[model samples]
Target: MSLESHRAACAALTLLVACGPAMADLQVAVGATSESTVALKVEVDRIVPLASLHPRLELRLATGLLLLSSEEEDGNAAWLLSPALRWTFSGERGAFLEAGIGGALFLETRVDSRELSTAFQFEDRLALGLPWASGELSLALTHYSNAGIKRPNDGLETLTLGYRYPL
Candidate 1:
């Protein structure tokens, strides 16, 4: 398939997964760094009802944008959509620690007239969350990189506070 077609397909699949059941949890977060760069994210889980991994391991659809970069070579913004798998230490939720790893396709990997070597990258996350009465609050650190698949693999890191509300 053409690159445009592939991007369309990926977007459609992301929407299909993110718009799961009506009862799923939706999370929205905005994060900023000292360098004046910003990141925005929205995420939800697609239920995979497996008895062995139902509550412990969950599939998440994470969509985000990195914008307003301070450095010139980093470009303006990078849009990312990734299907992630999270494994929580506490299987049934509540207070937990989770680790997630996934591959992301970017709308553009070039910034400031420079190419970032690849449009495909890997996303890694680590989070600690506690469920409140109506929602869950999480502190997460995320990283994105090309994994040296191409030259000039400049990686990014963002720390965020996220909230998930049942919808």
Candidate 2:
């Protein structure tokens, strides 16, 4: 994508971030990739359910904007705007399994040695979480890839321990 397009995408995401507070929960997380590249993420998620399979099984549609900055040599950051479908299966107490899938617009195609080849990527996430201290704590693994839409589709994976507090 051109520099102007990236800037325009950023501006649009900024507008969503500004307006997200009225209907969603703000989430901030700090983590690192398997290569030890540090990263910070800011997101907003809303609970939009699709079904209630069981008393403990609930499916939700979460729409959000994620701004991610990582410690790559080039200092390139990514802005991901996508809608995720989350499956929350309750267990003992407040513990649950979190799984989500979505697509993202990766602002930068090259990060370090990975050449994604395209700005569009798919996002998959899995987490084990529990409620604690009026917030939710989770250990999450997230992946980003283009699903072979283009050549040299190198993917990125990140593991993060995060806390989400509803405002």
Candidate 3:
């Protein structure tokens, strides 16, 4: 990653954390990309119930960091912050599905041979979650891309298993 890009991403992440709402959940996840690169994530979900829109629907502001392991040691990482809407099907059971679209800043534009073309990318995610007594267990698939705004937008995808604990 270029020094300027790294600083900008870090600043954005810090702003996300510092200005966040009071109630939130912290989640940690581990997985691998389709190409087998190791991936890890740390995220915070700021819960906001939207009863007016729908009883079962809610809005969440998600902020996080994603780290990817490159096959040939080229840098790999992305920082994301976005808003998501979640719909809970099982009221008391706490089972839900959510999807979100947000912006991401990559640590490196090129991971191995995949040329992302820009440090700024888009983050899209779909997740299924179930909450137990202690916390929540979730399975999520997240994608990062430049949305054809530039050339060589070879996107990145990862499937992850995550654990969320309220803080």
Candidate 4:
């Protein structure tokens, strides 16, 4: 990645994290982006009222890095920025299911010689979470793709486990 891209990513992440509500939850997530890829993500989300969609809806901002680790693919990575809306069901205690969708921008479009066509993509996620007084534990399945906006819109999938702590 170019120095400019790194600076841009840092600036965007700062903007996302700095603008969140003072008492928002901070989460750190780790898991596989694919059979050959691993991802580590961090997000800050705040409860926002959107009763029509669900009682426990949140506005979330996230950023993560995907690590590619195969022969020549080693040392390859992408920085991701996503702004999403999440709706939780079954209330906020015990077991809960959350669904979310948003747009993402990747710092790199090609990894391991696989062309993702463009740097812009869409992300969809479904997650199961267990909330505690102090924090939450979650497992999420997420997909990222260009939605045919460009040719060869090869997509990526990630399965991640996360921990969220109030901040």
Winning model by lDDT:
3
Q: What are the models' TM-scores?
A: 0.67, 0.77, 0.85, 0.75
Poorest stretch of ten by lDDT in candidate 2? 60-69
Q: Write the per-residue lDDT of candidate 3 for residues 1-167, one digit (tens) a residue.
A: 45675676567557646644553677789998867888888777777889898899998787788877765774577877868889999784579998999998877787676778999989899999999668888899988899998999998888999998777
Q: Quote model 4's TM-score.
A: 0.75
Which candidate tops TM-score? Answer: 3
**Model 2 regions more than 4 Å off:** 1-17, 49-51, 63-72, 81-93
TM-score between candidate 2 and the true structure? 0.77
Off by over 4 Å in 1: 1-23, 33-36, 47-93, 111-115
Q: Give per-residue CA lDDT, model 2, range 24-106, as digits (tens).
A: 66666778755566766666666655545555555434444444444445434566553544445554337777677777776
| lDDT comparing candidate 2 with the true structure | 0.67
Count of clashes, each model: 1, 0, 0, 0
Model 4 residue 141 lDDT? 89
Model 1 reaches what TM-score against the true structure?
Answer: 0.67
The lDDT for every candidate, in the order shown, is: 0.62, 0.67, 0.80, 0.68
Which residue runs of candidate 3 sit more than 4 Å off their true CA positions?
1-23
Off by over 4 Å in 4: 1-23, 51-71, 74-91
Whole-model lDDT, model 4: 0.68
Against the true structure, candidate 1 has what lDDT?
0.62
RMSD versus native structure for model 3: 2.9
Better of 2 and 4 by TM-score: 2
lDDT ranking, best first:
3, 4, 2, 1
